[model samples]
Target: MSILYLVKKNDELISHCKCEESLVGDPGQLDCPWCGCGWLFSCTKCRKAFTFAEAKEIDKTWEELAREDLLGYSGKEPELEDINSWIDCMQNMVSHIEAGKTYIYLDGCFIPADEENFEFEGWKSKHNFYKTPQVIALKDKDIIDEVLSNPQYWEENIIQEQ
Candidate 1:
């Protein structure tokens, strides 16, 4: 089914794509099948669009092309549940977003250790994409700053505090 992709324009409404060709989902923009109103995602690059499910599948396909990044010293490596838990606890997933990087786009490889050695950087991922969303590509810029500002949430769950 086709879905409508809308973006909030300074508290206004803007439709990216009509819900006719691409797929769409519910309100939050999460991938939910059988949603009342389908929601689609527009490519920040070609301005192409896709339904929630379709975008997800596309993500899956490009996952390999995605660079591997160490989300953090999640004690050692990153765990889906732990990361997801942090995202839930913080209510924002792209905490330490990098410019031109899509935290959601990249598939996290959990380390499961406790700390990064000299061999590891704080995080690791691909260089950059030739074509993608500019905003989504750029780090939330303040994501890491925001996380640092909020100690309770970051330490309590995300980082295995020493």
Candidate 2:
């Protein structure tokens, strides 16, 4: 259910070198995440992509990685199927999407969120998980800003006890 999860940079979507859409769909999405500048991907919430310095290297594997994470497809070659299932799956997951965070929307043959807590018998066979936030908003502040301030907001928000 890879709904072309969005990424951002400096509070803006990484424009495609050509398309320039904040989010680029699959298959037809043949340009950069949004900006065709380099091979960095920004997490929309974090507005951060792989540093430009690593752009060239990431190009070799960025699509493959996104494919695997988004659709549970292998990096080498993938199969094309109706995107309806993906859409349905994403719809369900979106229901669980909290504020102050973004979702990755990872879906494969089956809905990633189908399993209990999106897990299968203590083992994750194929990954279709969205990296979402627990709270999209906090105290009137936008979750994006919170993540921009601290990518580890989730970790930091957690109360560590002895």
Question: lDDT value for candidate 2?
Answer: 0.29
Q: How many backbone clashes does candidate 2 have?
A: 25
lDDT of 1 by residue, 1-162 (tens): 321122212211224544343222112222221121111233332233332221122222111111111121122454565545533432232233222221122112111112122122111212222322222213443532333223442233332325
Q: Each candidate's TM vs. the true structure? A: 0.17, 0.23
| Candidate number achieving the greatest TM-score relative to the actual structure | 2
Give the root-mean-square deviation of each candidate in angstroms: 18.2, 13.9
Instruction: Name the runs in model 1 displaced over 4 angstroms.
Output: 1-91, 103-162
Residue-level lDDT of model 2, residues 1-162, one tens digit each, is: 232233221222323223232231232212221231122333322232321111011222334433443443223434434344444443443344333333332111112212233432111112212322112222333534554234253234333443
Q: What lDDT does the true structure give each of the candidates?
A: 0.25, 0.29
Tell me model 1's lDDT, rounded to 2 decimals. Answer: 0.25
Alpha-carbon RMSD, candidate 1: 18.2
